[model samples]
Target: MSQLDTAWPAGRDVPDVEKLIRQTREQEQQPVCAYIYDLVALRERAHRCVNSLPDECKLFYAVKANPDPQLIASLLPIVKGFEAASIGEIRTIRGVSGDVPIIFGGPGKKDAEIEEALERDVMLIHAESLHEVQRIGWIAERRQQRVSILLRINLRRTLPEASITMSGRPTQFGIDEIQVPEAIRLVQSLPFVQLEGFHMHSLSNNLDARLHAQMVATYLQCVQGWMQEYALSIRYLNAGGGFGISYTEPERRFEWNDFMEELHQVWEDYHIPGIQLIFEPGRYIVAHCGYYATEVIDLKTNHDQHYAIVRGGTHHFRLPVSWQHNQPFEVIAVDDWPYPFPRTEWRQTTITIAGELCTPKDVLAHEVDVEQLRIGDILLFHIAGAYGWTISHHDFLSHPHPHFYYINGT
Candidate 1:
């Protein structure tokens, strides 16, 4: 059992799910697959996440994680703002978010996107490269306005225990740290762009609290030195969110208190008047508020290996496949086995769970332990609120899309 006292993630007995299934079956709707998000839980989760942070910090929801209008609307009141990766995300946030600050980020931003950001007056544009800074200055100069910019710095030192490293290596994310001085010089030459601060979003999915704290400390040290070197006034230090949620061992999770305490030290050590610390957390904020449900279609033993096939495949839920890790799920035992034939019994056995697809790469959970599985049991995957449906291939094999439902938490 995972210790989730404040946040209720599992959809084992959520009312909306029962009602959704009943209504869908009543109207002869296929219970192929559907993603249910508990807005109340999401709101409460957001509160818990932001409230735990220090006053010197600001929490911004990463709209690229869910981007559901309802979810965004629920979080608007709780979060300080949103971090968007594309123009579509900005538009999506614009519909539900009123007057909330939005930060536009992404490596390959279009010229039209710069126009839209200027038109919308986004909080700032994170310049990933020198060319982007020049383009933004070009656009702002034509508009007779000065656009605030944050030079995204790819750090030279790498942090340990991160699942994915974006800024740690020389890849397409931000300006290399060695080239920061040149970028700063270019910004100074541009008349329409004002350098607000630095953005160092290095790691992704980092679980260790100590290492996470060390990464923040490193960012603070790097930014402080750069500000002193260039004689620049830094406004915002955007430490891009990379908090990790344990999918396998839930008992051993990220230590929030320890991490926050470490942040308190960093704030004291790197104290600069009026410089705000911003965190854009996506997965940690909303991952627990969603549940992906699919009905069991077939149960068989293929070549002495038990396999459980569901109505939905990796097409609808691809997080497990994307991470190359088996997603953890709980069995929602529905006793309504309608078939007449006696299903094969697999007591105390492990099975491979997959979806109904022609190819061999449609696995959702591999080698999962199951006490018993019948014809019509529902499999509910936890920690799915973040990148569950938004990142999936929805139209493979022309299968009907799954029904989406937003439910309550309590």
Candidate 2:
């Protein structure tokens, strides 16, 4: 098959994922299909995120997104802490760094998870419901240890436009706004549960930076009002991260520089001396650092539509199918055709890339126009670091797992 040109971001001196894919193909004896990560890019992104934030703002990586040990370790020095959604995540963070802070947050926390979080001495446990608060208080009282927590509030305000809305509606995530007073009263009565602040994480996969700044403003205002009305001395405002990475349009990204400037203005206008702002972002911090490279196993045309079937499918990387969007990809033409038969190829045609699964829904990219592709070509899906492997149904077809490699930063 003929070689195809790959597009790189203009004027950005970043180590490209294409180079890594090529290197993997050359080294692997078998057909190369793996999830490769660039530690250099991950570290650079983490450093940029930390440096751009206001002095009062702290960046925390939510471990639910790409909990690979190496990825977590690479980000340890730059990020202030980690936001773990489960006990397993807490353990994962601890396995990487024993001293690094961890905040446990998620709905439907079992008693065992709470006990483990307390044992680990996590920085904060985001209490989602009144029952959870009481459970924590009970556990802490039984253990005779005072524990600090932030109440996850599902605010009544309408959320900004986002791919997923976790709050501002009836959801299993956090406590409703109307019940905050009752929760606070319950917390006050509990001897061991100390209310540190509020955790208002409302959105997921949000792309608009301006809207994010406005959301931050609203959170700060709501917290300020609560502080005044209840005579409460809050210490932290955990605005859970919803920063997005564009899978459809790579150029259309979250404007971090502009958002940071606006965040600084918000801090200056609503400056609270002791209250610290926490942002636990999972997808944005590591999404661009990962790439999933799958070699084309077969090429064909069905009813005038071109199709490229890869060795891996939604079982290995499910983001595109999960979000129902065309995942951005680039074709790397491999000229080595060992077969005696002539290699068939498609030129300047739209192709639907699917996996070797029984169901027809195992599509990665649906009808994406490509310059050229062939049976031996490799399609590298970018921005796949977070929510790719962990969220996939790996054992659905009992297919062999994909290889994983990390490119250590030079």
Candidate 3:
């Protein structure tokens, strides 16, 4: 089978998993929820993604996905730059990107953040609001620098949404469609502000390649009309990335090769000079590179429903609760169950996996079928490379943070 078609967690660095499992057996860490990443696999996957795009498309790693130092160091050399949403993310990428470009974008940004953007000399600051543009201009004027700006427009259009939507309609993420004219005026009025392009990121975890390509084509056309109507020159078109990875339906995942193939047609349909395409993918780039593991603490059946309580709760890995999907998992059985009491084992039975949190929303997977699960069994959640740790509320109830391990190997 083709590399792209291969089932994930199959070709990944399994030796690392084995090593971690052995560590758990040795009691190196108790009830640990560890994220294991294969840097080599990530390098290969990212290289393919970067190479598949046309010359106009430049890939930027969104640091909010996973700002782990090792993750940034691995992707820093592969991607064009990092796209950050807050001051902390900007600082995180700055330490590793070196001369590579960085873009700062987020709504309701503080004046202090604007100052930091100027001091850091970001490639472009996406103006999500009219006031944000004025703030950027204010900062640039004081610094005596012409700051490049990308006007983020929340269009009136909609696409097939995944789990979340970052743009389109009246979202706090970007300026509304009707407000663009006033926004343009605000940018043009500033002496130190340079309006170079537009940023339209409408959806998150979008899986349809043809629809995604169509959205980009439509976005470019829409931007072109606005530029001509406003008499502005568009130098860059940031097709902010919402490319998706399948959490439940792995077979229905986005086809990178097919999507890029369609993108080739989309690019040719509206190829323009001096208009560099920017793709800031947060989930798709790193979602498949990391794994989250938790050990089973207890097994019980309450009111005819079987359940397995895990060591960590939504405080450590919250994607299942956020997405509201029974996350897929694999059971790594342990031969040794050190408990003195009689152990509960299930076969040909459905079980709900829940976390140790007191809240009812601490469920990880519901009604999952397993083969012979004991108290010491490990549950490894796949497709947790992005938004797994960082998105979680680790401080809830002041629980101990899970151990994080970055593994690169043969």
Candidate 4:
């Protein structure tokens, strides 16, 4: 792929990976590293994805993945809105750009959160069930205001990597497909609630672009049928965010042009006159843009096998435990010459990676190869921009979170 295609904001030459690593070490900035190039690449990818969508479609950055204020601020101008799952995120977005449209989603929202969203005039409140709709309506009515709402709908597919799913069996999230009609009726009955359209978050690790298009088509059909049967005009259709990122080697990159083409075809086939398309892409937009930099505290041999132990563990990059995601990382000394090795050989050895914590589960990678891992060496874990630091446990042995930096080239 071209550099522009791989970098965020598009069209910039990134610093050499090895060069950046050496700089970090020469500065003695242990546990203080950033994925400068990765963030750039992620933004580029996201921009391409948004540009590929039809004119009517809108892209929303799901802030739950990594709510770095700088990242959100940088994306505000490029994206249509922000998908906030918590009150803090809502407030953060508002702090960055008050006028940026906000979509309040997630289950079990606190009353204060709803009140805050209403108080701030959020663009849309995604109601996961009839109860949430009623609650939002009650809050809006007491506040003497009307709020736009979308009923979160359950889908047919469930993702294995996600903590929550709207498909397959019963889930605590969106109302079931069968109950959507009644839920719609209830939402319509509420004076302060405006039923905008349907919202569905199928799965997180959805790599198939065609499957995404198929799901959109199916959802459009369902919404069309509902609109016709109920004689109601739906204003917005939200296909909730489940875009996947490459966390493992042989990483699967999201095919933006192909996916958008398929999505456009589906949109043309099921065009709704006055409806708007909204997409919440969290991981896809930020995953590859971030990296985790940790130092090799020690090295050892277990059963005649080499292992490099770093200061961080599953507490910092938990995708390995949560999704069994094996993110690719590179190891290099601060000033040592690059050890020459064939690509095929580098890919063949088993150099197990571990973190500083004592638990065996602290392992980061297994059967990986590094030129020469030694004490004080730095390892740069790539494509960690999405859920890397935010999802990790900082309290584990009281190891403070790594420092972060944001780099954008114009």
Highest TM-score against the true fold, candidate: 2
Off by over 4 Å in 3: 1-15, 27-29
Model 2 lDDT-worst window of ten: 1-10
For every candidate, C-alpha RMSD to the true structure in Å: 2.8, 4.7, 2.2, 4.6
lDDT string for model 3 (1-410, tens) is: 12344343422666567677668657765765677776777877888788778887899988888888788899888899999999898888778765679888888789899888778878999998887888788888988999999999888886666767876656788888888899988888999999999999888888887889888988878887887799888789999988878888868877776777778888898876679999999888888888888889889999999999998978988898998888877888777766687877888889999998989789999998987888888888887888888889999888778877766764
lDDT of each: 0.83, 0.87, 0.83, 0.75
Q: How would the candidate models be sorted by TM-score, starting from the highest? A: 2, 3, 1, 4
Error of 4 at 202 (Å): 1.0
Clashes per prediction? 0, 0, 0, 11
| Weakest 10 consecutive residues of candidate 4 by summed lDDT | 1-10
- Residue 13 shift from truth in candidate 3, angstroms: 4.5
Tell me the tens digit of each residue's lDDT in model 2 across 48-159: 7788788888999999999999999999999999999999999999999998999999998999999999899799999999999999999999999999999999999977
Report the error of model 4 at residue 132, Å: 0.9
Model 4 residue 24 CA deviation in Å: 3.2
lDDT of 3 at 271: 75
Stretches of candidate 4 off by over 4 Å are 1-18, 29-39, 156-165, 249-251, 336-349
Determine the C-alpha RMSD for candidate 1 after optimal superposition of all C-alphas: 2.8
